[model samples]
Target chain A: MLEPGQIADLTEQLDTDDAVAIIEDLEEHEQKAVLAEMEPEERAAVESALTYEEETAGRIMQRDMVAVPEHMNIGDLIDYLRKNDDLPTEFWEIYVVDPAHRPVGTCQLSWILRAARDIAVSDVMKREQTLIPVDMDQEEVALRFQKYNLISAAVVNEDGRLIGMITVDDILHIVEDEASEDVLLLSGAGEGDINEPIRDSYKARVRWLVANLATALVASFVISIFGGAIEQMVALAILMPIVASIGGNAGTQTMAVSVRALAMNELTRSNTRRIIGREFRIALLNGGTIAVLVGIGTALVFSNPMLGGVIAVAMLINIVIAGFAGIFVPVMLDRMDQDPALASSVFVTMITDTMGFLAFLSLAVGSGLVSF
Target chain B: MLEPGQIADLTEQLDTDDAVAIIEDLEEHEQKAVLAEMEPEERAAVESALTYEEETAGRIMQRDMVAVPEHMNIGDLIDYLRKNDDLPTEFWEIYVVDPAHRPVGTCQLSWILRAARDIAVSDVMKREQTLIPVDMDQEEVALRFQKYNLISAAVVNEDGRLIGMITVDDILHIVEDEASEDVLLLSGAGEGDINEPIRDSYKARVRWLVANLATALVASFVISIFGGAIEQMVALAILMPIVASIGGNAGTQTMAVSVRALAMNELTRSNTRRIIGREFRIALLNGGTIAVLVGIGTALVFSNPMLGGVIAVAMLINIVIAGFAGIFVPVMLDRMDQDPALASSVFVTMITDTMGFLAFLSLAVGSGLVSF
Candidate 1:
């Protein structure tokens, strides 16, 4: 993945469909050259695959699969398998099809081998099998595989005819890909692959920074409102970021957990409220602990007991607020039919930062810890 | 996984080895009850397995695999499989063992079914099959399965005797578990399961915040040193967090990419320098774009061109420093044999915050922008 030239080298030697998958990852000009050098049939296969949407099962599935008609007996199936030299190199099961070429059932090799050779293929085949549609998104395909514990599933066209098969190996990659994608998207990094081109990396990352700039101004505007209080006590300026930074971190912790749980199907409508309550209590406990520690450190360093007391209460308040923002932002996004991880950081940080500044400065001014 | 009572109910109906796995996830007291309720032989097996370390193959494998001596012909193997009422309900391959019961090779069911019944198992077996060590870590097992595209692999003891088999279904869970773990750990959140008990969630998340408290003080200490400058020009306080927040975000973006690449085995000794160079150039471009936007925003809002110039310089310097810390911290941790994702946020944020404060304040003081 690091060397483009090496990728081009590897793709040329692989099976045509497999080569197409690798070549699709290359830059456009590199892809053209790789495609042009292929045999016409192979090139046609590759070019047709490129027409499918990115991240669809059509683009990721292997074209090589073993399929036989349902009327064949176990003996005939075995004879055909032995006589054919071009069967797929690896296959755990054979798809049983009808005259119309639609897959009717699947026959695992174990059952076929164990059965008497004279037994009809349809007699031993499993009729209830999962079928993947051609244009199905890869993420949903992975979920179906996970749910059914499928080792291999038949892919069907709109007419319900088998086209290709998706193996467990492909689903493994999709699961990891989707999981890491969520983590990166939450951080506002696009695709976040180390092998990503420099221009693409910059384009993906800088736009998020620009969005952060817009949201950070909201915090700045809040700070500008409290400028008078800050000028009177430089210690407030020193301590303000402590409140915001810790709050931001706490919110991120909650958000990471929430986003992950949603992805795993562990946090759903049936359990969301209960989980939120659990987080709230944990936040209170964490907030109280940090408050006492920060409070003692602040009083000793600044020699101001009242100021320490004010900031301690503010810390507790801000952390609790952070806990709410963390879980709420992602949950709301999910309910709105949006990706739970999309720019969650930007919104959660906005809440925590605003609340942190508001709570600390307002508490100090209200308590007469600082007077202009 | 959500309720102990539900787990107890589910485990009671499963195979003894499977029951043991579910019981092991419970508290010690709960484990005792579950084990006590089991049949004597089942309890003994579960007890022996519990002695092995968590996340090891010993604790997770099914003990009901089909193991046949290498001399058995395909006909006899099929007959033995049919006669055995208690063989594993699901398996893709049959282990071919030597006289001493050590695995010599594997015969995929597909191969056996396709071969003549009179052929010996050894003739049809693949001798180069992957064998998993009994006490191997689950993560290592997953990597092997992924690398070889295995449907199933044999587990062998230290004495080279076959003990059990790990199927692809088990590896699927481990891959998802390990991937989610990295995301959670990077956020300083423990386990991060919504189904995890409230007490457990608190224990995992609070310690990191306390550590954040300690690291955050370093930024505060830096701020206190420049209290005079902040008191003289309060705009410094209003604009300071924008620098730190944006820098922290950029560090997170780069760190997320680097950490994920390392996890995926995409970043390594061969390409580390090239990747670093790529990131450096991207950082410079990102920094320059952000600097221009922030500089213009500050000059217009604050009505102070010199202060704007100072902060723009600080933002650029801090963003570039963030890029270095982002990649360097995780790579160094990887070299030291530590998890690159473990508390990386704490270290990376520490660098960006400290630098954000230092750069903005020192540059202001040096450039006479503060009027102190």
Candidate 2:
């Protein structure tokens, strides 16, 4: 989108990999033109990074890190750091590297500051450290960082030599992005970026709507079978949506909770039975509360006690079913190595809507509340 | 509920405030009994923290931090840290304080380790360090930390003297909590925790269902008005729910996007018009696609071209309205200082359901498509 000179000027202000990303977005000929204007060293680093797959640790790590010889004394380490102006300006820990360049240990700044002047780096440094594999998925890397509460971790190549470092600042963005991704995907709302291109947004969203149209047909087929009961009593038509909509809302509530629990790893096989029992009990409580209110209200509005009783039973049955379907569907999806939140709402709604219609209409017909 | 001895044993492993929180959850008499058993120093610190409201920075910050006088040289600071066995075991930076004990600057360990022993601490310390107010809400503190990419920040009292510190580890919990809160609140799904007590879960979820029921009544009233049309043609009853449910799903998709954009600060007044226009265009495309698919399928199933045509036009109209209500309602809520995600689903469904019914049934009645 820009002239070669403009790209060169802009890329100069960005990190090497970031600059390479912008250039790569342009035509192949323009990419070469932009790279040609960069310093040879900068060009090489960017080109090397461009070879890594996107969203991997290799693609995101900063190439600069403070790695010092393992044999240096505290005083000599300080002197070396002071004299090396090319070293990174900001770092939390100094990596202690062996002769072959693999990280042997790490010395946090706190340890260095607290060590005696004559103490050897080997003695002061902590021998244990979490190392990030160069080709690891960014999400897995983030999970490791979170598990260890890491401020920064060294990234090593397949051969185990230190290549770069990944900091908490970058992981912060990844965590936020991943968390929001699940929430958006639940609603079939693609990435949900307002600034995304119209074409990209349509491409992401239209297919989901099409999928929804398919699921909604399931509910419609159920409704079509209940046409006789609905035609016999116009009141059934008035009340059908209320039952289905309420059931859908209840299902969404339980689904939201179950999805979050699964994501947090709080609900596992060890606790699944207990959690299901808990939801079942909660559903009964919720079901009982809603049934009484709707039953009493319907009776007053329609002046038919049997009609009210039929609806109350239908409401109870649908709500309990909603609770079960909400947790069961997501758990089943998760067991199959699928993301529990993805299209969960669509499936949950399908079950609730179908069950809501089937229960209410079947009860009405059987009880002769609305004779067909 | 535990014996005083068990409480004392348990408290030993927890941070002072966390121990106090557990004690405070007990009855007043038991709280006093537990606090009395704590060491005097621990009790004093816990009592001071208890004075701050829950979920404030003061309640969360660690009391231990590395604070040094600004006049010290790098060698002197290093010696002090080495000599002080009572100082915190983990620290990222040393706060350089003035005579009044107010933080004047911060010296990161990396900078200190890289500096000459003869250099004054102030010479190497960063003066523009982030300082958090003690009473700031944890959420606001989290936002500040995220915006600045801070690993740790000093917490200052009202007098601007350093009191405690908050680390990125704690902020991780806050960020995750806030993100999940929005997702759960949007669904009106209480704190959907698998471990939440049945009573607590029931209390949280039922109120939302009750609110939804009230909204569902509006749709019911609308359907009640179209009773005559539905009785004359059973097809109207079968088809009505399809229109409303699809429209509701469409509204949810748009609402989810707008709410997330608002949470991320991606959609603001400056970009509101552009974003709204983008959603509007996407809606037309989505509406057109859905209308065609549903129209073709319905016409073939019912063998009534006019009936399909009526439903198609209704689908188009309702979907466009869903797009508007989804973004419009959330935006207005945000403008009025309400959380855009809270209760947004309820209001959006109400609008979509009403419009879907109004457009389809009104058309059916006027067109005499169901006048058998």
Report lDDT (CA) for all predictions. 0.86, 0.84
Backbone clash total for model 1 is 0
Sort candidate 2 into its docking category. medium
Total backbone clashes of model 2? Answer: 0
TM-score each candidate. Answer: 0.88, 0.89
lDDT tens digits, residue span A25-68, model 2:
78888878888887787778777877888778887777878898
Point out where model 2 deviates above 4 Å: A1-54, A68-72, A97-104, A156-163, A370-372, B1-34, B69-71, B97-104, B157-160, B269-274, B335-338, B368-372
Task: Point out where model 1 deviates above 4 Å.
Answer: A1-20, A26-51, A68-73, A97-104, A118-123, A269-278, A295-306, A335-338, A367-372, B1-17, B29-48, B267-278, B299-305, B335-337
**Candidate 1 clashing pairs?**
none
Judge candidate 1 at residue B184 and give its lDDT: 91
Cα deviation of A74, candidate 2, in Å: 2.9
